[model samples]
Target: MSRPRPGAGAALLFDMDGLLLDTERPVFEVFVEEARALGLEDAESFGLSMVGLSSSICQRLLRDYLPAEIGLERFRERWDAGVRARLAGGIPLKPGVAEVLERLTGAGWSMVVVTSTRTVTARSHLGEAGLLDHFLDVVGGDAVPANKPDPAPYLIGAERAGAHSRDCLAFEDSDAGVASALAAGCEVHQIPDIRPPDRPVPQRGQAVHRTLTDAVAAAGLLV
Candidate 1:
């Protein structure tokens, strides 16, 4: 994908879990483990379907999938606990995250995180990953009326960065995230992680790359 030169002061919006932090696989493992502990036979499939979704939506889906006796709250408690235990040490950063952030910072681009994770949790994870300082703000799942694939989160993220959505460039690692950014009118580049982009090919000039490094490099940001 060729780079399009964004106007001066154009913002950079990012997705957190799989895009910036390598937390998706570990978290999905915890989800599968918790589900199987409850004797759910299709745990892996269900867990995969929840990728890039908001907590509320995931909870609602869990409610439908789990036996009434198990209860969503009880399942969430166990699943969240497992996630915490699994990530207790620290979240890992994806390759070239720090370098890209540093390069973008030097280039004077404003940056914001637009993630499906809750505000507090996203903040904490970014801090743990040593990436909190690079962003001007975070727009979490709970902060917007709707999550990814709806465009509200990215719209809010661009607003927080004090730029119009059309002026922002978004980096994402999921189909839902790419859709959100594209719908919000941002130039999007995706680096798929954990799961491939199952949705139809991106429209509006969006491109998918193998890694965050390749995405940014193609955008001419990593001179």
Candidate 2:
């Protein structure tokens, strides 16, 4: 695809979980399993609702659904154990992630990870997936004052890349992520994973595509 050159010094902002790493489904499955084990009703539905949210926010939300006697701490311990076991080998990369990253890297665009996962966990997962070297920095949920659906994470990501948000192109896979990127003044392309977007994604300077390769092609980043 032939297109206008990207702005000089433009950077790429990426959401790590569903967008770059195929970790959402397995992790969420663990959440549902743990919730079910604790006898929570509508476990799958509740777990899906937590997608794209920060761990802190999800824990808060879980408080309302979990029985008072069960305790959030207990549920969290089991859930965390399940997730670790499921990911003990390594996290898998999303479809087209390698190609998209390679293309963008070859184009000389700096990249930063903007994720709701905690900084240490995000770094570890990316390192295990062999994707850590592709990004210049990671702006994790714990690193920001607020997480997704808020602009702080993406704004921090842009700042870390030493570029203005407006000059950055963000790739996400969830509505909350898309909203965060857009609110941070970056152009966004969402590639939905476990769940399709329930809210209306803005059309101007934002788009939804089926895969990372398709999104990159639409952005004229694939030639």
Candidate 3:
């Protein structure tokens, strides 16, 4: 893929869970506990499998590991209840999140959050983290027919930002997200979550960074 033009109207797109917010850890911990309660000993690995998936996709993926006695809907209800309880107080922002947002904001770049979370839930979590006001708009999983790894969400995100996909820099923490952004023609900077992808995601406009700060710098939007 070609580089974005210097004078183009550039936008900064971000993933929510493991990328900008630290909710994945607490959520996955709850998932493991729930899985173990259902007599699944290898719950940790099962929880890890859900890392970057949307709720819909996750339900499908989780069905393989869940017993028939514990159906997908019931499992989701239990996981939701547990995660909500654990995050009743507030969600933590990932390291360098505030600084990176501030830097990009000060530099006058348009910003949008393109996440695999549901619209209502994603908005609530962003509000709780005190980061909702930074984004010009949010494109959640429910907002698009197809989610990450399908590119529909990111494609819609660019449209929402009123910019071409190639004019955006998407910050992600999962291979699925990287693939989504790349497929949408956005330059993607991946900062892996707990477990990084074993192999490179084969796509255009893709790069990996150790941290959010590095991603911002690489995008040339550092203030």
Candidate 4:
């Protein structure tokens, strides 16, 4: 596909959720509600940990919390409901998303969204944010075998975006998302949202920024 003359960036990639929109707050709020309903708020978030992890993995990670009285089936139902509620409420795009996306796309940066949520939900946020058309393709959370920290999502997204991994830039938040992008050979820019650093994320090879605009600027998406 013919694209504009890429100014400074070769290609621009982004992760959904915390990277694209302020999704975690609503998600966590729903989780809290579910936990309150199930009486496992603290334990559930501990298991549901990061944004880019698969629900299956998340469910298994919290298996320890499943009492013999509370089976996995019920846990799954309630958790899915909570997630559905969060999605139903919709989410907001992070500040500077539209400016940076427009800037990068105009500069011929072939941008794609590689996310860990289902395509429907990913599309919802992008559409809601008016950023859906910015991406050439989207790799959803359910599209890959393993989610972030595994490299599949990023690799697949790179392939779909017609970008070589080495020639692409990944914008992400969360440790898992950073690791996945780095592992896929993209230079990663990590914007950690409001997540406090309790443990080191994969920042050794990453450009760390506080916001999408800063990361996009640092990645050469803006002049």
Candidate 5:
């Protein structure tokens, strides 16, 4: 692997959905739209709750959204369409994404993406945002057996970047992502998109940010 850019020490592993693109809202929107067919509102709320898990795991966890008489495959079909439309409209990077990434890239930070999202979906978001070139390597959900909260993704990301797990910085927007990176022994920062219902303080040990730019700025990724 190529050397990471200056100042950041080694690698920076970025989450694909909420980190690279504003996918959380739109993803839940798709869920809500699909749930509407089954007479469920607030799909976005319930959907967002499953943000960091693998899609299949999330689907299983949310199976109750579908009527027993109806197969989950149908719900998936509808949800897929909704998501495609949202992505087609484009999902912009969170505030400061460009500034932080540009600064880091210029400074020679080796960067890659490790996401619990399918490559097809990942490509749609990052490609549309015109940020695909920024990643030196990508590990999509479909490419891995274990997902976020498992540590496998982060470990693979660090390995691919040719960096020590502890030497890498991971940017995440979900609890699962934070846990995964932490389990792999990487330093983590969280760009909180939404507060949980039970945890008033959100999760701990994470450098919380209102946006990716803020987190990066705090980490001095701009250097």
Candidate 6:
């Protein structure tokens, strides 16, 4: 795999869930509990499939398993309320995240957070983490007409950062995000969470890293 350096004027983009925040496991636990309550036996698998996708997309993905009486809108509201209560404490940051962010900021890279989380939730989470100041802007899941696995979100992120997509380094933790960033023409690094991608990698111009620390190291950001 080729290790790309962040040269002058290069930008950085990040995915929120699972990648920067340690929210996936706990959030998925809530998902499982909700699904079981709704009498869906494949809750675990369903939860896994929803990783890295926006709530809107997850709703569609889960439509088939939803009980007809409950309906999509009501199911979403109840599930969101459950997850929100569970996450009321705070979202935890991934290991070495602050160090990497500090180093990258010191090196003068413009940064943006491009996430599949809705704008309201994304803002709340980042503000709670005190990480909002680290980014120049945020492109939320609702900001684009399409979500991950589509290039729109990442493309918009690059545009908002005022950098060409090819000059940006996108960090993500799932195959969906990887595909999005790659399609947008960024040099992407995937740091797997929960499990490795079912698809083979390098994934065109993207590379897989063991962790965010490894990604920062390879990017030579500490220099």
Per-model TM against the reference: 0.91, 0.92, 0.89, 0.84, 0.88, 0.90
Q: All candidates: CA RMSD in angstroms?
A: 2.4, 2.4, 2.6, 3.8, 3.4, 2.5
Which candidate leads in TM-score? 2
Q: Which stretches of candidate 5 lie over 4 Å from their true place?
A: 1-9, 41-45, 196-201
| Model 5 lDDT tens row, 1-223 | 3323454457999997777777777777677767776787676667777887788788787687666877788878878788778767567677778777777778788888999988786876687788888888888888876888889999999888888888898999889899999999988998866555666545657778788777776786554
Q: Cα miss at 69, model 2 (Å)?
A: 0.9
lDDT tens digits, residues 1-223, model 3? 4444324676778999999999888888899888888888778777776777898888787888788787888888998899889888779888999887876676667889999999898998898888888888988998998888998988899888888887888899887888889888987899877773574454555777888988877766653
lDDT of 2 by residue, 1-223 (tens): 2343545767889999999999999988998888777677888778878989999999899889888899889888888898889888879899888877877787777899999999999999999988898889998889999989999999999999989998888999877898899999998988888863565554655788989999888888656
**Winner of 2 and 5 under TM-score:** 2
- Model 5, residue pairs in steric clash: 4-110, 5-108, 5-109
The predicted structure with the larger TM-score, 1 or 2, is 2
Q: TM-score of the candidate numbered 6?
A: 0.90
Cα lDDT over the full model 1: 0.86
Single out the weakest 10-residue window by summed lDDT for candidate 2: 1-10
What is the Cα-based lDDT of residue 191 in candidate 3?
A: 85
Sort order, lDDT high to low: 2, 1, 6, 3, 5, 4
- Please give the distance, in angstroms, between residue 124's alpha carbon in candidate 6 and its true position after superposition: 1.6
Q: In candidate 3, which residue pairs clash? A: none
Model 6, runs deviating above 4 Å: 1-7, 196-205
As for TM-score, the candidate ahead, 3 or 4, is 3
Candidate 4, run of 10 with poorest lDDT: 1-10
Give each model's whole-structure lDDT.
0.86, 0.86, 0.83, 0.75, 0.79, 0.84
Candidate 2 similarity to native, TM-score: 0.92
The alpha-carbon lDDT assigned to residue 100 of candidate 6 equals: 80
Candidate 2 C-alpha RMSD relative to the actual structure = 2.4
Order the candidates by TM-score, highest first — what do you get? Answer: 2, 1, 6, 3, 5, 4
